[model samples]
Target chain A: MPLYYEKKHQVQFYEVDITSQLTLSSLLNLVIAASGEHLEEIGVSSEELISRHLGWVVTQYHMSIKKMPEKGQTIYIKTAAMAYNRYFCYRSYWLYNEDHEELIEINSVWIMLDLNTRKMVPSDPEIMLKTGAEEIRRPQKFPRIKLPKEQLVADKSYFVEYFNIDENEHVSNAHYFDWMISSLPLSFIKSNHIKSLDIKYEHEILYHDSPKSYVHFNQENNRSYHKLANGNLTAAECVIQW
Target chain B: MPLYYEKKHQVQFYEVDITSQLTLSSLLNLVIAASGEHLEEIGVSSEELISRHLGWVVTQYHMSIKKMPEKGQTIYIKTAAMAYNRYFCYRSYWLYNEDHEELIEINSVWIMLDLNTRKMVPSDPEIMLKTGAEEIRRPQKFPRIKLPKEQLVADKSYFVEYFNIDENEHVSNAHYFDWMISSLPLSFIKSNHIKSLDIKYEHEILYHDSPKSYVHFNQENNRSYHKLANGNLTAAECVIQW
Candidate 1:
């Protein structure tokens, strides 16, 4: 069994939206931080991996929300590295209120990458052993995100700012959530809440890359589809159920 | 003497820059959040103040930094409402490392505004009394931010997005620091550290306002001047010593 790690966090004012509920992007950051701490506790920190020119790059995420945490709410974040294949690693994260009621559940897939070439590489056996993840022959299956039937409209563009770049020298994955949600109408955003989200990262976005967000909302299914791209190079695609 | 409040915080990855040091904007958010908690404890919380159709608005800030905290560092943030006159209130914030060594100091001026009218109003005696702040006849003084000696150039333009607006229904003041810093060259930002900063807010920027960041750098004084403007209207002006 993989080792489990948990930490308590208080949502700050800067992490919330106008309605006082935590933003999706901030929620992702909190979960990722918890995972980072978990790895560090297991003696397989990101910095140690970076020193060997090997880094973990997220490929996909599937999240379900019962309710978003609000400002000033103290919640517990729990994470565990469940299993790993030759090239892919699977992890799970959970957010719970003080009462121990689950608020959000997220499962993510990551791949080890050679930083020098930015190419996918096999997970090192020594590092994988440190995480206490079980070696699996088969990869975990996630729901596939279908492309929008209608042509998506490029509604907004975002310039990669200096602050957006993370220690990994790439735009943090959480920013993609912000870009996707910003493409929707303010009225719709204020009235609707996210039920579930599935996102897949295709190409990595770098500094100064001006990416445009393409969006399509289906009224019949109450679903929204989003694509972040720089010209023809798509960086990420996401589907949100409202 | 006014009541003071202090809290300890562990810097998280999201709060740091590429170099692992806390970003100036994040530092401001930490300080402001500390003040919010302090006011809440004093029985003059922002919610209570807003219910009466009144709100506290920042007018000016002067800050001096000895060093910026890094990721994984535990630091203490302390704040107090120093004094208040008829129309202006003074507050001070200090950030200290685990050893209690001072890292950053900020002095700010605020005004009570009638939310309905958006007009400046006198200090509410009952609320001010709750803060344990001494009423004074004279307003506290802050450094004057003079206009740039050279013609400022509009280096970058930023569109106010949905997330930029805070609960006050205006763009958060901390974001202005981001816009100003982003106006500088990445090379310069990476090489230099901020020594001091003085900023004065003239008007509030709202959603969808595409404001331009204008900057002027003086080599002799190692000072940079920044102005955020929406067409002919100026939003904020700042000077930073490196």
Candidate 2:
């Protein structure tokens, strides 16, 4: 039988990085959207998943970036069940190029929740089985860290805009990091994929005047920092592992 | 029967003013992307749109925006065939609210191409059927005017970054306008959707110093001017119709 979910997308020129490769965030968006479409084909959808008071929220994901595809290159995405326990539903994702063996793999875990109440709940066994994704027996340990402080780092001045705002009505989480790294000269950004990132959303940022941004990174520890200036608005702190 | 040859989409957040209404170029992108998607589903795609060494290119389009949408509101987009003559394939579009009353309407034409040759081609019957989006016949039309030489009227500024650069290795067309508008004082960008615009691509603003952006608009003619300046790099020009 054909795979239950498969999508081939052509990278648009708008989705490329400075070096002309697809950015990590763009790849992530494509993967998630493809998964959402996959769920829809298998009788589940983000809209229904939330409406049924059954939501899948990412608790933790440890991803490794090996390489990125170039702009205009077509890529295929395939997903399957890894395994699941009562609390953690494990899933795996594969990214492939034209030849099909060129694959990038990801192992991720999600928690089921009661949307209205915003409470955690175990996976629905019947629902999980119907989807037929491979389930993993052992859950991997998530990278541990201290509580990220919401503070400014790089005192670089900048202006924020409308496109940075997402459906959530604030500057998107991904856009913040994009701003942080883009602040560096283009040559520096062209060679990076933001190896790892840990961010804590402390306060919502509103659209304002001459918005300011700060960045801090320790090449030794491989950690980066981002802090936005929104007076009275809660500050956001992010930790980038690259 | 379910429609096979076409689909319609509304002008929403990504394409609209802060009021959630529509912008002129965004109105163009909305129909272009949607219609392109429809064509691709049927085995024809923009990638294959070029023939005779010529590809379809947007030489120019003019629109007059009378109204736009409000934030969190829904808008309707109806697209259909206008007319396909020798040199250009005409297409038409309209925007409406939930009540079905019209908001903004447009009519534009695209040239047939020979991609390899970078030259024009006549609309052959097979080519027209493949890329013309011929199913819907009742598209709307609105008045258009001559765009000014420069879109930069009132002079506000913005900085270019990695994300601002698109696959073309240049600032994305839409983004130039997005930053120009967003850089405006909050009082100006408060609306959710944009009404109308007259823009022209003056130069390809490259990713150097991530150039600075400038904006000038006279609200009187609904005439606005936007410029992307990185010292000497004047990346683009746009005129807005209030």
Candidate 3:
């Protein structure tokens, strides 16, 4: 078993929405940063990886939520690299309250990209060993996400700004989640709490790309299907169980 | 002298821009939240103030920046309620490095508002007393700000989203700073760092209000004047020295 890396965070007022609950995108960003810190402690800093012309890109996330962290709530974020195959690395993240009760669980898929070529590259076993993740022959399967076939319920266009781009010079993955979730109606967002989320990123969005986020809500299943697209090209697709 | 409350913060990755330096708006949010915590600790919580149909609204800010915080850098945030007159209260904030070197200093004006009537109210000396601040007879003078009269350089329309609103049911004040700064050209933002900033809030922007951010740049002075307006009505105005 891989050793879990843990970090503590107190939810700030600015991180929450009007409902006093932490925004979904902010929660994801916190956990992702924790993972980055974990890698830094293990001597595999993102900067070092970038210097080597390689970087980890998240392809998918499957999250199960017990309770969304609220403003001023202190929680522990834990992450570990579970296993890796030739092309994909499997990782897990958990959020727990101070009392040690799990608040959220997430399983994610990451693949190394040759930054110079912008193509998938084989996993570096030497680096994976440093993270204490076991080598696996087969990649783990994540939940499949499907956009609803029904008519679109809402859509909003987002003009990418300089702040949206990270050090990678591309729109950060978590902001896509923000755009997707914010596309829904305020009434629907206030009345519902997300129980689970499954998202798959298909394309990288660069600055100056004005992507439109579309949402389709399935009332029968309490599910919302979302798609973020730059013109006709889909950038991300997500399914949220409310 | 008022007691200064100090808070320690390690800049998170998400708080920084592509250049790895903290965003201007994020820095404001961090310090503003620190002030909220300071109020909470003083037993004059914002919630209690709101419950009494009272709220503190920031009217103006004058900031001098020595350096912007960078990602992964830990710094100290300090705030103090300096003094209050009949209507306006003066407060100061400082950001310091670990060596106690001052990085940023800000002077701000705040006014008490009657939330139910949405009108200005007299200062609540009882609440001010708890902060260990003095009751001065006269208000402190802040630097005057004037918008440039030159032709408009850039204008961008922003649609307020659900997440933009805070617990107060209005667009969070710090977000206005984001919109103003983002309206400038990315090239300019990348090349220049703000030396000082003076901003005044004129009106509040609500959800569904599509405000246009306009910028006027004075090339001779390296200054940018900004205004956010809904149609012809102004919401906020700012001037930044680079």
Candidate 4:
């Protein structure tokens, strides 16, 4: 039998856009929720998926925003293991109309590690067997990132929007990624496998002030260095890898 | 020339899901917000969209979900006029990435609706023109929903999970729809266009009790109906236009 898992999710009124289609972000949300459902179904809670010392960490995803369904569109999500290799585990995703036929696919990889020691751990063989692993491990790889100019520093500023702040009262990581990656081209986005992204905040980005930006890029290593500023106030720095 | 209307929006975290993606509910929130944005960008306000005891109401929508970007994706939206005639006007939507490439597309029709009267009105020519009239009025249409059937009515038996309850302390409408529609085959969902849905809640669905359910389906009309038992007391009637 083909390896498959399916879960049903409802589209709330809030999910609809002017064209009545679900936004791309919302689609990812449903995909995550469905993945949660799958884990829950198999008696693998987020708590269980974690290492004895380390929590689960999502390092990088080379996801394609291929297609989105409409608002109030009932989505059926399917997920399965493609392989467990190298420092990462490969998983595949498919979203389809309720019928479980036509599919929209998302592919990603993740890892298990000792949280306290912060070292990669061999995946639990028992857990892997239960989750249906048929393949071995290999070195993780991704496409190169196309960075912009090598020396573009903060000149234009951005006033933090109220929505940019999350429940944590900080600029959300997702928003930061969106803002950063958006300045680049989709050609770059589609081509790269995000390696590791390290972002550090030197200061809080407030809602009242217009935050300016600084940027640096190196095409050779495919790294992008970024900064956010407001007047002389420095807010944050990020180094993206692919 | 192509019609143009710019909209400004904010990003909220709760609107996103576990995959750390934005959810459909958040997309709907954006739509609502964009309405205000649209008017503001055009040098008007929602106050103008609302006439003397009148407002534009969405009667029906036929849309396709194309793609959902990741969480925190900040997209630019614009509206254009497709057609307008007499009491009806058609609108088109473009969701663009920051670089200005269209990421999502949608089409809809609106009416100069009388709020209190709940009726379409033949508005002034200049007003329609200002809104970007696309074409003359035609029959506003969508997939037809089937009439609901009365199935076995049971009372007081349901399980409410932690996620089922939103901040509102009641079962979310999305979850309600999820359970209501789950009973039917995925095939029905595949073939049918969800024409319309009307639901009224008489009481709160608590997390404590197992809520009862009644199933109803009419294949000819392509609809499945549902009712929830009220604490072994009474039930709420639901109508689904499939």
Which candidate leads in lDDT?
1
lDDT of each: 0.89, 0.59, 0.89, 0.54
The residue-by-residue lDDT of candidate 3 on A1-242, one tens digit each, is 68689999999988998789988879889989989999999989999999999989999999999999999899999999999999999999999999999999999999999999999999998899989988999878888886764676548888888767887678988888778878888888787888999999999899899999888888899888999888878898899999
Provide the clashing-pair count of each candidate structure: 0, 47, 0, 41
**Positional deviation of A205 in candidate 3, in angstroms?**
0.8
Which tens-of-lDDT digit does each residue in B156-195 have in candidate 1? 9988877787765578888888888888887888889999
**Please, what is the TM-score per model?**
0.97, 0.62, 0.97, 0.40
Give the alpha carbon lDDT tens digit for every residue of A34-129 in model 2: 677677787776667767877776544445545567766788888765567778876667778898865466656677879788688978876687
Over 4 Å off in model 1, which ranges?
Answer: none
For residues B93-205, what per-residue lDDT tens digits would candidate 4 score against the true structure?
66676667775555555567675776667755765555555545565454442324445444224555333344334554434544554444444543444444444444557
Candidate number with the higher DockQ (3 or 4): 3
What is the TM-score of each candidate's chain B when compared with the real chain B? 0.97, 0.65, 0.96, 0.56
Q: In model 2, which runs have C-alpha deviations exceeding 4 angstroms?
A: A1-4, A49-60, A80-91, A107-140, A145-152, A155-160, A192-242, B1-60, B63-156, B167-169, B180-196, B203-242
Model 4 chain B — which ten-residue stretch has the worst lDDT?
B147-156
Report the C-alpha lDDT of model 3 over B63-166, residue by residue, as the tens digit: 99999999999999999999999999898999999999999999999999998999999998888888888898987888888886467654888888887888
- Each candidate's root-mean-square deviation in Å? 1.5, 7.8, 1.5, 19.3
lDDT of 2: 0.59
Assess candidate 2 and give its TM-score to the true structure.
0.62
